[model samples]
Target: MSVQRSWVIGAADCYNKNNVGLLIRKTACTLKPDVIISVDGDIIKIRSESTFKNHDTIFKLNEEFDEVTADGRKTKTTVTLDDGVLVQHQKWNGKESKINREAKDDQMVTTCIIGDIKAVRIFTKKN
Candidate 1:
């Protein structure tokens, strides 16, 4: 039998913003190749490899508001990528935000914000 390498990646409530009490914990694991696979959870995955030369990853967040807007107008926001790419703009249909990228060390420290609230998704290129 052949052995397979797997990584158990997870975070504790210690890192969660809502778990101030540290009572709630979340965890997950996956093989390196499975990085391209999507999972049903709030977690984001990043992978690195020689053949690929770079890693691509995305994170999404969705939230619903009591009202679409204070003035009853649809709220919209634009997102800019590290490459100076204006990926997309969002309008109030139950706000969904996403961050995507082709990994590069310099891009790791780069970021974008939606309105006044900073996005929680972060991708770092591996050296």
Candidate 2:
């Protein structure tokens, strides 16, 4: 079977961000690519010192999130999550999500406690 293309698209300083770096490294390790390619500058230097692989292909990014051709043609690219079936997030009629109904069920519990405390105060009559 042919391998699918897994491109890590990000800004020039994406490597500087901890979350972004971890994400890229995690993807690389998970995919286990023979050679890691960096279209940005610092990422290549950073990944080269990593445990994954010393082999790397460094290609400069012509723009922030665009690639230009030899004929000076600019094509815009974007990274996005896989789309799937939409599920209902909010409750119908503005109800809360997964509330503990048991708490509301025990409404009389607080009343009983307050009654007991009042009874004790009445008997003790401490000024």
Candidate 3:
């Protein structure tokens, strides 16, 4: 979407944190985080605020990059968008995770999956 949008957590489900890694665990615990997304051409920037810290990531579409997660783990990250859906893939330490985000009305719904453990976070778009 070529525009900056602010989003706030409207709902989340992250109960079984033990099934995932530290990064996902922290996210599971931070149920009500805030996020701001800026999309400009092929580049997308995402800034998120959690209970403990604020994280910012900037990446171009379909490009793979190295990302050190908030839990201090180094991971390879790639982001792509297709058919109005944004997908992110992460790999590290022989583990992998996928995240999908799509806009439904005025809300951005994100589904995070690591193995069979899935966490859903819904954010309401603002302004």
C-alpha TM-scores of all predictions = 0.25, 0.15, 0.85
Worst 10 residues of 2 by lDDT: 118-127
In order, what lDDT does every prediction score? 0.30, 0.22, 0.80
RMSD of each: 13.3, 27.4, 2.6
**Index of the highest-lDDT prediction:** 3
Reference-based lDDT, residue 97, model 2: 19
TM-score of model number 1: 0.25
lDDT of 3 by residue, 5-31 (tens): 889989988746545577667655765
Candidate number with the higher TM-score (1 or 2): 1
Give every collision pair in model 1: none
> Arrange candidates by lDDT, highest first: which order?
3, 1, 2
Over 3-89, each residue of candidate 1 has an lDDT whose tens digit, in order, gives: 012222122112233311333212211112222323347533333332323343333323322222212335454433335332434
- Stretches of model 3 off by over 4 angstroms after superposition: 2-4, 15-17, 20-31
Report the number of the highest-TM-score candidate.
3
